[model samples]
Target: MTPAARTHRTAVLALHYQNDVLHAQGCIRVGLAEDDPARERVIAAAGQLIAGARQLDLPLIHIRIAFRADYADLIQNCQIFRQTAQLGAVKDGTWGAAFFSGLEPIEDREHEFVLRHHRTSGFIGTPLELLLRKLGTRHLIVAGVATHSVVEMTARHAADLGYEVTIAADACAAARAEVHKASLASMSLIAEVGSVASALASEKDSR
Candidate 1:
């Protein structure tokens, strides 16, 4: 098949790099060990990815998962959502819902945007797609926590929405190594699987 024409407009979607998921005191860090090398690697790589995006002047969109204090708007269709309220994790206005250190959007920056979602995919129940459309972004570089869920689902949703999707594999982490590997493999079928370095290089080259 012939390759699609490059649009040159790309944005980075940083999802779920919140304190509740990455912090040692996070409630959602249940199965994730505080000292896990894989988790640390993800944090480092994601930090690098964000820095690279900023240096390249690419639009950076930080997607977070947060619910109301009582979670009245939260859907309970999934175990994760159900457990969210029980664990009191990612409650809006709490530190747990805040972005992790060094991974936050620069306030007052025109290129940096923030969107919150209650579902697994950033596009669902959020203005992510609308914002991307307004910015004329046809290509997306995605990185986030829980490769099996948010990363995978959001990339898939972006692909289905006709946006070229690339996953920063090294910038994503899961509670289990095997699950992370399996999720990346599965997502490869729908999105380009690459590391933060590769994604940055591609963006630089495109410019």
Candidate 2:
């Protein structure tokens, strides 16, 4: 990628560092892991990705999942979110809906954008496209939780929407190792799949 183009790349953290997903007592933490080596590794990689993006001064876009208290905006047809409704997870204004501490953008960072979505894809029903266009984002560096769900869906959607997508495989997590690997394989067909270090290195090389 050209240096000018790479300068417009956005680092998207999709539901990775969120209370409902990454916390020990989180409602959906069961979908990933707790006190496990794989989970720890994933978290560490994602944290490094965030730190790298900050070092590069890239736009940091934090995508979170949240629904209304009454679940009116949540579609019951989506099987994945049914568990969220049942468990009362990610309710707006609750701790479960907040971004994890030490992982979110600090206040007064003008380039940092936080988006709340009720569905799997970040672009769906969100101003993400408009924001990206406004920011002139040509590529996306994606890292998130539940590789088979939010991470995969967002990467595919971004690719189809004309944005170059790169999946930080090491920075993504799933309910199981097999599932995570499967998701990465599937995503590799559509987007570049690599570790956070490689992604950052690619950016630097491009520059």
Best by TM-score: 1
In terms of TM-score, how similar is model 2 to the real structure? 0.92
Model 1 weakest lDDT span, ten residues long: 3-12
On residues 35-136, what C-alpha lDDT tens digit does candidate 1 reach at each position?
A: 777667788998999999889888899999988998998989989789888999999999999999988889687788999888999999888888887778
Q: Model 2 segments beyond 4 Å from truth?
A: 1-7
* Candidate 2 lDDT score at position 1: 69
Please provide TM-scores, in order, for all candidate models, with all chains considered together.
0.94, 0.92
Q: Write the per-residue lDDT of candidate 2 for residues 1-207, one digit (tens) a residue.
A: 645543365555545478888887888873655667776787788788888887888788888888899999889886777888999998988999888776876657767788888788888888988888877888899988889888988899999988888998888888888998999999888899999999989988887
Return the clash pairs for model 2, or none: none
What lDDT score goes with residue 30 in model 2? 36
Candidate 2 residue 29 C-alpha distance from true site, Å: 1.1
TM-score of predicted model 1? 0.94
Candidate 1: segments with Cα more than 4 A from true spot: 1-8
